[model samples]
Target: MTATVPTSALNLVGKVFKPSELRFPAMPPLGLYIHLPWCVRKCPYCDFNSHLAPDSPLREVGTASVIPLKDARNPRDEAPLTHALPVDLQRRYLDALIADLDQQLPKVWGRKLHSVFIGGGTPSLFEPALIDELLGAVRARLGMPMSGEITMEANPGTFELARFEGYRQAGVSRLSIGVQSFSDSHLASLGRVHGGEQARAAVAAAVQLFDEVNLDLMYGLPGQGVEDALADVNMALGLGTTHLSLYQLTMEPNTLFAAHPPELPDDEVLSDIEDAVHARVAQAGFERYEVSAFCKPGHRCQHNLNYWGFGDYLGIGAGAHAKISYPNRIERETRHRNPQAYMDEMLAQARPAEVRSLTVQELPFEFMLNALRLIDGVPDAYFVERCGRPLSDLQGALKAALDKGLLDPKPGVLKATPLGLRFLNDLQSLFL
Candidate 1:
């Protein structure tokens, strides 16, 4: 969520620190994020910056030529689908992304990337060769360690064995499949393009191709029960995924569902579903490392860890955001939201849509906002190192939170108590 506060509000306690006063012991580890902003069709509940592709030739997976949808399956039975993306548009977008990366390279001139995340509105829609070209360009310009994790988000609707194999050969080490649910009824209610069968098939293919796989699941759907939600969780675990990202169905403002809300599960049912899902995942030997992230031992997502740890990242592509830390201050950058506008801006070599430096008053809250999300919290040194503020700066809020039973009394680390985790927003507000 975005907030707008007057600059005067930054004058907290009548004390203000200049950017020049801030200094970090060392720069944090860096990650790279690439966003693809296109989907075959828009979901009614989706609030992401995704758009349906323009009219083009349609083709099925594993085929070299375009084919009518009716020839393979009844065109009337399937949702209105866009054609496979044009190769020219794919190349254009990839080139624009490389240009965007080049523009930001100087910001991270000497840093080596620890991880890369290729996320989107169905990044699987692009052909394997296109992915190879994209990653090739990234490796050419930036220094990615040999052990760096390269993850890409894939949708079941775009899954193909040959394509996934090609991606593996192209240097992708991890795959995050968007398998929201294994229930066909829930999937249809969510406006997903693929059915339960396709989701299963995609997961099967993913486990065979990628050593690390993460499955995205959702609960609290319309007419969903605790049993129904657990069934989805169990199915995903059975598919041999190393990580699970379970989310509750939310109706964000401006989305179709928010305007005409669905009849979702009530609070009681939602709570029951949450408890059951947590218990089941725990029984399966998965740790709830973050609020919605569960992972088996040694499989926590490094890209996300970088974010939660308040490390720096360089985000490229349409609507992407980046947080960069310099010796003197920390700054945030966001690109143009519209795809065409972003491409055009990159071509013209203009400034990003927005850039802002964090004020000293905001640093404590911003650091805690990300760090406290971890179940185990972060080391005390992280706050000092990342925010460039001494532990004494947080002493007041720390004492208050500890007294209120919202923070652990541990000496060397800062972690939320169970009660704090339950009321995280209220706990984090203490820092402000």
Candidate 2:
């Protein structure tokens, strides 16, 4: 067997760095990302780092009495609070996450957060009180805006008026309900617990409390026809949500569906569904901003927009990932995936992160990869603002792509033509 490489040997630059040389820039318009990694049951199509409880032996643990984790410099800062579970149930593991964030805050203490998103296996599984406490801690530590966007992803089955209201009162201004599809067969095939009616009720509750409500719908399911997918889109629009994120189902590695491949719709049917959904959504006053996202005026998800625009964000919790912009380059970091492993690493005072710095050669392609996702391509100047470079930086590759008619001839800006968007891989390959 090949000799094992040390963790430090696997630096982001593929080269080892001395401690003194390792520094990241003050992240830009920072945002917070919290991952909740537990689920009642795992979805076959979901490749997210999540797991269901197993028949394991007993273990009673209490980090509650332990001093609440605070930022190293700002001792007054509060963090997320977790629900207490009996010895038999799985723990929330919030203490470890708070400790991890505390250790990271010194690197970026005074930055103002643009958004905060709580995503998960099922974020609603956490008690509303825990969410309230978490947001309270965020405001105490990071100084969020009075009207900043706070979004949480939830499942339809886990809903109550009190909990929804608590989330609003806790400072959450947006809600993204995971209503993958309205068809019972589609929902069942995806192993989703909620039915069609449950999705409706969940949207109703969210609309009542949050100013921005988004529905997460999935298309191109196993055995799903174009008409079936269109029906799902129509049903979601009827709910009157401000935003909708319709994703084409992808069979990612390690997912149950990948291991046992299902009979998915052919490319023709998939294309039909995409065309139908796009037309219907446009006619209903919703504009297709991102490839899979549709929104009313000013209703786009700011957090996702930041991501696509290559903005900075801090990710916390097991399996969370983050990207930060520094003076000369961008750095990517990831937390340990295992809950137990993350806690152990945090409790030992060792950094539970791995970092990488990007090179000049990689920046242009990276910027275009994200910016081109918008329906209307970004202005030429945004490249410099975000990537800290100019459009002329990648002239050779741009000229090649332009000669191939893959890019529009719009001076100072790069826009993908219809053919380019269809074969984006080929267009992007030129940059690579």
Please write out the lDDT profile of model 2 over residues 1-432, one tens digit for every residue: 011222322222223334223222223457789887766556777889765534212121121121112210111122111221222233336666667778778767667788999998677767776777777777778887533799998877566677788888888899999999887667767766566766778888889899999999998888898889889888888888999998999989877677776788999999998888888899999987777789998888888877776777889887889887766568778988876687778767677568887676787788778767776666655555565554456679888988888888887456777777887878877876
lDDT of 1 at 119: 91
Task: Please list all clashing residue pairs in model 1, or write none if there are none.
Answer: none
What are the per-residue Cα lDDT tens digits for candidate 1 across 1-432? 112222322222224445446756667778899999888756666788876665423322232122222332213454433235666777888988988999898898888888899998778878789899899989998866434799999988776688889889988999999888998778767767677887899899999889899999999998899999999999999999999999999988767777777788999999999999999999999998888899999898988988998888999888999999998889999998798898889888888899999888888888899888899888777766677666667879999999999999997677899899999999999999
Q: Candidate 1 versus the native: TM-score?
A: 0.90
Mark the 10 consecutive residues where model 2 has the least summed lDDT.
66-75
RMSD of 2: 11.8
- TM-scores of the candidates are 0.90, 0.83
Give the residue spans of candidate 1 off by over 4 A.
Answer: 1-20, 56-82
